[model samples]
Target: MVVIDINKKYPEIWEFLAEVPDPEIPIINLVELGVVRNVEKEGDKVIVTITPTYTGCPAKKLFEDLIREKLIEKGFEDVQIDTTLSPAWNTDWLSEATKAKMMADGISPPTDDNKVVTCPNCKSTNTKIISKFGSTPCQSFHSCNDCLEPFNYFKCHR
Candidate 1:
């Protein structure tokens, strides 16, 4: 439940690293998705802490490499990547703006745990879960009854 105000704490680094997009969802950046956690700069070394959306996430290695490459591309020499699973990444970490972006992209962002799924295409509550797993393990396949469009609902992970 402890969300770090990373933007303010590591303003320079965070702002620059915001360009690294999620491989699966190109519209969203990794930083705002809550995958990238803490950032520390010690001397010439920069440490980036991250938590995967899922423990066995397939993009885990890609995330580390992308972050390292981006840092190096930005003139960083010694970049250290660290993984932390203590607090666990959750959908709640996603900001309202992030959710909005997901919605705009035709992917339904997670809502309250008790609420029914909403169709991103037409904002309809009448939706059916097509599959527990969508294109990615973090999302679930759903079809909207009103729009008749199939979409992915970013699964709630906490």
Candidate 2:
């Protein structure tokens, strides 16, 4: 890769980063998870800003490391990863396409409104929370009363 104006290569950088999947949620890429907030270049250093799904999330550090490694592998030697909490990360930041992908993968995506969480298995609104936390901190365990199927619901973050 020729070292030139970084602004001109923003799209290419983003496209490359899109291939890196979330360590926990392999079904969705890091971009789809809204983990990657921004990418910028200053001098010869490329800075990447990411927001964790929750405060104190263990995977935050892993995300930073992975991002830095990926950029380095892409020939961006002076890569810097920045963790930002200013705007904060909310499930609402997730796009509709991401939600649909999660639902298709049998993981209920987080919702902005306090509406009933539809079961991914049967699309039933008759679901009860089995636990506030699921396999991961960002998810909750829920079982559908209609289908009697247990599934993980991505908890809404504010």
Candidate 3:
């Protein structure tokens, strides 16, 4: 295990992690997606705490592998990843900027109040869910009545 000066290496570590894209949603990195919970240095080892977006999210393993690969590539020999299930993830954890980006990318983020789903293409409230499940369990299929465009809505995890 190599001794690392945290003060000097912390920023670089975080920056690299921030650049690791989410497997399912390539557009947003793990940091912006709010899956990365905490980072700490313990005795020459780097420990990263992460929370899965959902209990059985298929991307969990890929996320861990990617994180490990990234840290190893960055010369962190002893890397520890801690998966925390407590205080399970919530859609509210997502940043406003990320939500906006999701909408812009043709995926409508869940409405906080569970109101009518909006169409990302036309910004219309006349949208109906075509299916409760979309490409993934965390998403649902919806179509805009006005624009006749189908889209995915990132379901809100309460």
Q: Which sequence of candidate numbers ranks them by TM-score, best first? A: 1, 3, 2
The best candidate in terms of TM-score: 1
Question: Top model by lDDT, which number?
Answer: 1
Q: Estimate the TM-score of every prediction.
A: 0.94, 0.89, 0.90
Each model's lDDT:
0.88, 0.83, 0.84
Candidate 3 lDDT, tens digit per residue, 29-142?
997787887788998799998889877899999999999999999888899999988667778777789989898888898786557788999999998889988998789999
lDDT of 2 by residue, 1-158 (tens): 11122243588889878888889988888877877878989988998888788887889888988888888898999998888876767777677899999999899888755367889999998899999888988999999999999999999876
Clashing pairs in 2: none
Model 1 Cα displacement at 45 (Å)?
A: 0.7
Ranked candidates, highest lDDT first: 1, 3, 2
Model 1 CA lDDT for position 51: 90
Q: Candidates 2 and 3: which is better by TM-score?
A: 3
